[model samples]
Target: MLALGIEGSANKIGVGIVRLDGSILANPRHTYITPPGQGFLPRETAIHHQQHILPIVQAALKEAGVTPDQIDCLCYTRGPGMGAPLQAGAVVVRILSLLWKKPIVAVNHCVAHIEMGRVVTGAVDPVVLYVSGGNTQVIAYSEGKYRIFGETIDIAVGNCLDRFARVLKISNDPSPGYNIEQIAKKGNKFIELPYVVKGMDVSFSGILSFIEAVAVQQLETNEFTDADLCFSLQETVFAMLVEITERAMAHCDKKDVLVVGGVGCNIRLQDMMRIMCSERGGNLYATDDRYCVDNGAMIAYTGLLAFANGVTTPLEEATFTQRFRTDDVHAVWREKKSLPLKENGVVNPGIN
Candidate 1:
């Protein structure tokens, strides 16, 4: 079966086509490179989506050597993203589904991240650590659903990083997150910062404030380098995430851990998580920018599974949700035992 997926969640506009057998026929990706001077203004983002999304979608379909009529299923990110951008994707997918007489599946953005990690890692029951610009959480598969074990009480990890970058006048030209990652590598000294972890939940607003205060103080003294501060900030935040993820694995008795979402692409964060998981006799799985960052391929891959299991959204049910959760989705695999976990937290090869 051929499926088309569209993702216009935040700043990126990704379109892709995939077959039922988990093969990507064509994946055309694009993002609005917001100028560093303007930052991420929602109105400007919406305007950019309107101007660029369609062409990218058309290009993907053309590259896949498939006409719109050949698609059997239509899928798109349903929410947990900017409303304007989400609506832009939903309207296009909805119209295309109607015109082609194909079934439409509204996939949760976070669940897509989880599914993509599973696809990339081949992990049956890994503890999921999803970190992105708009979200940060620890999740696990339980009782036929992906459940949220713990999450951020306030702002997301990547959002905190972006805000911190802005305060330091760091460039957002290529990508705000990429710029911060580069600056952080040059940092040499570790600065003491607030490390707050209330049980499994985390808070970054306080940390951001503390960093901003330090930045201001350093400007007055003219004694601090932005690189050092960036490094310290990344170290503090990533340490918190690793702590929580390790805690969740211990609590859930899971030995395999999967890291998803945009922030999962950060080399430093992934390296830290990998080391922690290894120390506990656990395996860590992470995605590269292709699947780790926001994209339509994940949505389409997830939607194909959902459709095969008789899951489809009615045309009248078309609507965008701003706060969809990964745990809200029901498992769509063919067999329950396919995701069996051994007592030692390893997948049972005999089960599937």
Candidate 2:
């Protein structure tokens, strides 16, 4: 079966086509970039999606070398994202569903990330660390859903990084987080920042505020460079994440760790996680920017999994939500023995 998915939960708008065999036929995306030191608002972001969603969908189909008649299902991100942006994608998806006469699947955004990470990295039954602009969560599968073992008490780690980049007036051309990662490589000095980790949850508001203040005051004095601040921020926040993730792994008795979401692309964060996983005598699973950041392929792939398991969203229920939790969906497709095959370090998710 073939599926096409749309993603517009935030600043990005993407369309992707995937086969039931876990092959990503085509994935095309566009981002609405704002000026340096500015963040994307929901209205403007939604407008961006409205303007580009059609062309992007066409591009995805063209790249995949397929027609709508060949697609078996339509998929889209239903929630856990900005309201306006989510609605924008949802509307287009509904129209396409009608036009193509295909069934619709509404996928949770966070679950899509986890599913994509699992297929791409071939990490079976691993503790997942999901960190992005709007979410920070430590999740494990239990019962019939992805259980949230821990999460952010305040803002997400990526949000903190983005806001910090705004404070330093860094470029958001590609992404603020990516820019921060690049500059952080030049940092040698580590400035102290607030580390707030309460039990399994983390709080980044205090850290962001403290760092923003420090940047405003100390940056002018040349006492600390932007790179140093970026490095320090990365180190502190990542350490907190590592601590929580390790604790969750020990509690759950899991040996593998999978990192997903936009913030998971940070090299420093991955290095930190790798170190922790090594210390625990386990392995770390992570994807590059393609799967790490939000995209349409993940949605399509996860939705296909649900569709194959006799799941479909009725037209009346084909709507968007802003605050859907990860654990709310019943993951009917997962079997206890479902595992991807890996050959020569390449994962074959279709083998399941």
| Candidate 1 wrong stretches, greater than 4 Å | 334-352
lDDT values of the candidates?
Answer: 0.83, 0.90
Worst 10 residues of 2 by lDDT: 343-352
Clashes of each: 0, 0
The TM-score measured for candidate 2 stands at 0.96
Residue-level lDDT of model 2, residues 1-352, one tens digit each, is: 8899998999999998987667788889999999999999999999999999999999998998899999999999999899999999999988988888889999999999999899887788999999999999999999889999999998999999999999899999899999999999999999988899999999999999899888888856999988999999999999999999999999999988999999998888999999999999999999888888889999998998999888999987999989999999999988634444232335643211
Q: Cα deviation in Å at residue 13, candidate 1?
A: 0.9
Clashing pairs in 1: none
Instruction: State residue 255's C-alpha deviation in candidate 1, in Å.
Output: 0.9
Highest lDDT among the candidates is held by which one?
2
Residue pairs in clash, model 2? none
